[model samples]
Target: MLKEKGLLGNIGVQVVIAMCVGTLVGAMMGHSASMFAPLGSIFIHLIKMLVIPLVAVAIISGAAGLGSSHSAGKVGFATLGFFGFTSAVAVALALFMGEVFQPGMGVDLTGVEGLFSNVYADKGDLPSFWATVLGMIPTNVFQSLNEANILQILVFCLFFGIALSKLEKDRRDPLINGVNAIVDAMVWMINVVMKIAPLGVFGLMADAVGTFGFSALMVVFKLFLVYVGAILIYGFVFYPLMIKVFSKTSPVKFLSVMKKPQAVALSTASSMATLPVTMEACEEELGVKNSTASFVLPLGATINMSGNAIYYGLVAIFFAQMFNIDLGMSAYLAIIVTSTLGAVGQAGVPGPSFLVVAVLLSAGIPIEGLPLLFALDRIFDMIRTALNITGDAACAVIINDMVSKDPSHAAEEKVQNA
Candidate 1:
């Protein structure tokens, strides 16, 4: 269908061109590029307006669909398992690459002393396990919705959906149908907002590059390059391999269809913002079932942070090597566990990455140098956000196959009857 729209009409191509042009404009205009910031801000706000309600309704519809079939618990477990396992693997891979490449060795921190500060020291103190658990249970769900508290919203919606599924069909079907309609309307709204994506992308990039020029990046250029390489290895090599081995879907076709969502992810740098596009690609293009896409994708976007995990792991190792701290087995273990879990705990929104402070502090690495990377986080965030959504789609495709094989699911029942 996108092919029928011609090259100029392809959002992916338009986004790529916008990114290039924006970079050029920013490089030339410097701080004057701030003039375009409003364009990007407006686009992001429009997308955010729909994300909360869309995620809330879609999760309800999906959970109700699966819960009625008695497969909700199984699918939930499978989804979490995939997200947790892949995230751990991503951190491990980043650690391995960091150790092998030694991106922080032979580095010069000569003039970056002013960038160092201890403001983020308190961030490393993560909340207690029980505190984290309690935080997910919103006392007033309406307040949670108003605050756009995604994790709490997810918890409430899932519970509501399960309860709804227990009702008789006479009562349940109408609410489910209504929720589905809301999800459809949300998608339509997302489609309308996406029309100006190229202009929004251009503004976002131009402001980012102009505000944080590549000057600081030169100091960490090696780390940047290695980080990109690791991302490519995971995105191009690992995800495709998993899809080819486990799912019936063609990995080549999966990659091809994913370009649209990936482009949006690249520009927005917020998986929550990119979610509607990701959902459309999974259901409409990649043939992921609507029920699976609705549940797994929202959950994945919330908890699945393989890309962020990699960043944490690598950054920990980078700082360690830079400081010449000889990390023992205990330190590596701390980095792995903290990076994986911290990444999962992170919110899927765009902003400074404070979670990295936790990873660094967990392993006794310094947090003072974090500002060096903070300035460049936007560039890094854009790239990894793309990979993050790709992981979401990969899991959806695999889980779709898994659900289709379970005879208790409605889709599988239909196939069996056919």
Candidate 2:
């Protein structure tokens, strides 16, 4: 609806306009627009820099912080279940839409010579399934970081963070503080890089449209519908049912309290950056106890990426369509599973699509197809980020009710204790 409604004035639309202008200018300039490619690489590099370290410290910080707490295992499990459930539904929904819509079917790839990097450049000895399992736990963390082995980094952080979490507070505080500082530093850098997004998006768009022309953009525009539609359905239909089925909270009431943080998330496109408001909404506005809010909201931001799950799912399948790669039933299953699990590892950055789309690498899509996706990202990012934050708040409400010994008595106790 970004194309139709257009009232929200989201940054995505502004970037979309910039892309359009870039296309027109590039069409006029013709071959000279080739210069924009390297300029566009600046944005891609920024995204890479943001995602790698961001995912690393986010996992570590989340693990160490949760480890420092004494949250009930029941609450933790329930929150995890909520995120996984919503994420599965979201991806499935997107996969269905992509199949039905075939949004990328008519997109032209002609003249896109060398636009995509050879995805198989890093293809190693295809591991036996067991070796693949072992591979995720790296022998050297620094080596994993250097290689940008996201899967390995995720596994290592899990263990390190869990170990750090179990240490006594006297020993744990320093590590936790250090992790926070690293994450903050990365955030600052990302903020600086984002200032160039408009120019970067323009260059990327100019190159893409000049190569493929306006006719192909119809396909991406339609694909954006798939992304945004899945988000809307999940937010309005899936979550409303979740609220009703899981607890007695009025869906309207729950959604109403979330408006402030949801707005913040929509504007910023960084759930981690919007954490303070989300936490406040969960605790003060929605009446979740601080004990539950403290653990669930933070963990949800780090790991609960239902929105990213859907975007990447649709994208993986879309690109597979573009390149004429048929992912069989098993690969379809892989997309769902990988995307869901990948969401857990997705960095809570301003533009997280780059990280999430790596899930498609498992399906054998070329990494070169990514710039096209990146050019169209901001429009989709706004919607997905809102879904991510809403999923977090909704889980807090649902799990707050779930973890209480007596749902009816819990509210009374909360008020009395407060």
Candidate 1 clash pair list: none
What candidate 2 gets wrong by more than 4 Å, as runs, is: 1-71, 110-114, 119-219, 352-358, 406-418
Worst 10 residues of 1 by lDDT: 1-10
N/CA/C clash count, model 1: 0
**Residue 99, candidate 2: alpha-carbon lDDT:** 92
Writing each residue's lDDT as its tens digit, candidate 1 over 355-398 gives 99999998999878888886567678888899999999999999
lDDT of 2 by residue, 32-58 (tens): 776787766777666666666776776
Would you estimate the TM-scores of all the predictions?
0.92, 0.66
TM-score winner = 1
lDDT of all predictions: 0.84, 0.71
Give candidate 1's error at residue 207 in angstroms.
Answer: 2.7
Off by over 4 Å in 1: 1-9, 410-418
